[model samples]
Target: MMRWRSRSVSFFALVILVGGCTAAHSGEPSSEQPAAADVVKVSTPDTSPRPNDPGLDAKLAPVVSSAVALAEIPAAVVFVVTPSGSWAEAYGTRAFAGTDPVTVDDRFRVGSVTKTMVATVVLQLVEQGKLSLSDKVSKFYPEFPDGEEITIEQLLDMRSGLFSYTEDVSFNETLDDNPGYVWKPAELLAIATSHSPYFEPGNGFRYSNTNTVLVASIAQQVTGETLGDLLQERIFEPLGLHETSFPADGDHTMPVPSPRGYLYGTNVSALQTVQLPDAQLQAARTGALFPHDVTELDPSWIWAAGGVISTAADLATYARALVDGHLLTHEIDRLRIESLGQLDETNPATIRYGLGWMSFGPMIGHDGAIPGFQTFMGREPASGTTIVVFCTMRDSPTGVRPANEIAKNVFRALHEN
Candidate 1:
């Protein structure tokens, strides 16, 4: 699980800082050349262009293109849907060393954005009377510390105080040393349980991946079905999100036409800090150094928490549908929306975590990060405006989330225009 810092200012204020900057014009498409023997070259750009808004494109294209170049990201895809129209565009190459351009259709891991889907299933179970928001976690995992006091809603909202397993040194070391290892849910839970809670239940808001894994486990125990099956039945199939999938634990390969995911440093290094040393950062910025291709690394370590794969189009569709109440009853959707509370009381407008998702200003949905991939999907319910961004590189050399940063800029563009 990618644990992001919660110290940033409100999205609107931060957007103002980057929105006025002019687009950087580096990293133009190079002449096609033969790919290295080991590199997987994706030649087909099969995505048909969605309805274009020339004015919207003029505002968005420069923002995303500039961000990709400045961040040294291998590739990125951005999709925006507004009342006026929709625009979808891709930027950069499929591989850092190759010439093939990425397409809007290319799939990549959506990471913690999977939490929204898992949370949706939990909410559905509640609506069906199979579970309740007030249900105690101890009902499912009797031995978990303070489980008796933790409610299902607390777990969904990150108020359970459960320690994130991804924060465990051993777990991250394993990820660095054995990228191919397939992690079991129980194993992940065990790592989390071995540690003490960050705080008593509901005392503080901590974004712990353990809370989500526990929720998924409880949901599985209640329905006697795997989470993937539940999502496919309840959310994906009904919404026709054909491009999204919760992959099996053993499957590490990304779908065809997908760009290989890249990362600047090892998991342990990222755990310490996503920022590279100054010299290395400059080298990366100038294209003298490239990120490591970790596209084949197993994602099971973050299953239920961050293991879903999807494309730009699918994410935009899901984001809009989720905000529009396509996956839940009208009453339940209203409750879910109202469940939001300030993630940081000191900075109320920064971001709010609700039942199973988060809100950035008026945009309701979630962002995700895993090794080699970063994604953001959010839709403002009032205007039916959706923004989806996918970046092949997990973060810029300075530790900025490329997808989230680009989405914020895009939002600012819309606001300004």
Candidate 2:
């Protein structure tokens, strides 16, 4: 749900991707990766979604279509639910280079939205007394820099001060050169730990993939299980989210019926204007700033962070669940708000980041981007309203992210009407 912050790059590393990496890691999936259509299928998308709801789609489609045009992206599949009703719709082509149309049921990578799911699993573990949020990283991986000073809570909240390895220009360059490379979690951690921390643990806020990677590793250490298994058992099955699946470890394989993912970075002129964090990264970025077809890269790089593929309906269901505290006890769910920070201080209502999710005013969810796709979701608990958006291509002509921009239109359309 990092879209509350960086909808374009997945999270802090978007600016670091060679052609935009997986929101999961600085965005490396195997170039030899398998597409969902080639893998074991997710439960078939329920055929029940009607073509459109007159009251809902009639009003929302024009706004969305306008956005598709203005954003200069292709193929959007969106789902929105309001007090009035719910609707799912699609527009544009499945591939940036083809005529295959997209549908509401076509799957897209949910990206960092996986973090919300991972957080739910972590909280579930806490509820079961398997672990505690106050537990220190030293309790599991003491080798991590500042392991003793950083707590599980800080990792969950991105206050661990660990560098995000995905931001390493070298990492992104390597990722760009070899999207098929099967990256190990240890290797990624080594890259992150090689640098100094942004600040003392809990002293400042900066999103980093290292925190989540460490969190996932710690969870595995505690349970002796893959994060996918934990999520499948405790979250997906119970929630009846049949369309979701974490890509296999050290690989990228989404469920069947997924659209081809793409990366849009041909705007080298626009990219040159961006002030990247590291000079090395800027150089690497300069070398690979072009449109790319990343539909087949290994997804291991984004594991536990952003490498999730799901449909619009499934995302809406998950979004509502997260907002309503479906998987957690009421008291424990309240902890998600214990330490909150504004994603943008000037527009406080836009988003609030806490734990592993982002709150957009009353709506809750995240946004993600990979080379071939971008995703955004938001749910408003008060009215049972949820907005989910998917696009085959990421970003827009003016640099406005289509995923978040479409959701903004949906939210505004509902409230203004």
Candidate 3:
């Protein structure tokens, strides 16, 4: 919890939704759709969009630069938002080799962050009466094991009890064998259905990718369009998330002017090894700092649950609009927020889960990790601020906390001034 370029669905099918929201500030192209040959594109703002500081860029740049070496990240980008305006800045190199530095427009895979958009669409459907939280999965596909007992609400809340397909060894094996395989949503779901339910439907809460895939498939079923089409029609277009996209099976490219994504703490995948002569293996001996270029691999295996490719800019604006409930009514939005379930029993500070996101105190955001990208996005509604951070590596010795550190620094720089 803590959340497509395919199918030509019109974003303006619905009425124009306008707000005082500001577009992202970047000197580079922020489109999720990549251009040929990884060209660098930049666009610096003529006049600073107000974020409560004029020298904010100067202070924030150092934080990102330091985060790269301090946090041992490949590269990092941070986008900060306030009620007045927003801006994004990036530091470090785009790739692991050479001097190809990262720009503000560099797009990266946003892991579980994809969940929030999927949830918004689901709730939209619920509001339209096309679906209901209480509706049983059996209503859509009774053939799915335990379909009769599972509710759509349970699916959105990560209580569906469906086994995450990514956890299946065979799926990982296939992933390693053919990194470019195009996976259909149903095909991915089959891997989970092959196994029995983790528990009974709604019996327990365990974050599972299978639940989201089902939600996406159901959305496709209800809308008579692909999940990518639905997202385009509902969220991306309305929110003006030009730099956001849902890559389907055949798309194996990153956002134009992107960098090579790397992964650490892994032994099974096809990543390059950066082993030291006398290396002190970090955490689980999976191999420290294993560098893999998974940037070109087809990412359909994690569809719906974690398939969205987005830039720091799009996420910044999208986060505020999403948290502000610009697309849905207050009744449904409040219901979604009220559905939070505790994740940490003893020390649940902000570690809570709702319809499609997890909370970290007053900040509502989610972090995600695929093979080579670790992403975190949060919005503090009270201050009308949204913060997003992305790193090219999935994990470091620092875990996924580097992004959070960068965000906190930005928050303090903007608010504690």
Q: Rate the local accuracy (lDDT) of all candidates.
A: 0.79, 0.69, 0.69
Regions of model 2 farther than 4 Å from truth = 1-48, 266-290, 341-349
User: Which candidate, 2 or 3, would have the higher TM-score against the true structure?
Assistant: 2
How should the candidates be ordered by TM-score, best one leading? 1, 2, 3
lDDT of 1: 0.79
- Residue 371 lDDT in candidate 1: 90
Per-residue CA lDDT of model 2 for 1-417, tens digit only, reads 011111222222322232112223332332343233222112322323655678887788788878777665657887887666778878887666478888888888877888888887787778768789999976765344567788989888888877888777777776677888987676676678667778889898888888888788777666656667667766677667788777775556656677776554432322343222355344434554334677767877777788788888888777767777777877788778554543332231476678898877667777786566788887766677778899876655345567888888877776664
Off by over 4 Å in 1: 1-51, 341-349
Clashes of 2: 22
**What would the per-residue lDDT of candidate 3 be over residues 1-417, giving only the tens digit for each residue?**
100112111221111111000111111322343222221122222222234344656666666566666777668877776656566767778877559888767888998899998988888888777899999876876455666778999999889888888877778777767889887666666667666667777678889998888887777666555667667767887676777899855888886778788765343532333332235445224433456677776877787888899888788777777776666778998887677643332221447788988776667768787777878888776766678888887766545456766665666666545
Candidate 1 lDDT, 1-417, residue by residue in tens: 112133122342233223311011112222332123211122221233476789888887887677767766888998898878888988888988789999988998999999999999899888878899999976765545566789999999999888899999999999989999987766776677667678888899999998898788787666656677667767776667778888875889888879988999889888889999999998987788888889988988998999999988878778867888867778999899888643332221368889989988888889999999999998887778888899998888888998888888788778773
Clashing residue pairs found in predicted model 1: 111-306
Give each model a TM-score.
0.86, 0.81, 0.79
Give the winner by TM-score.
Answer: 1
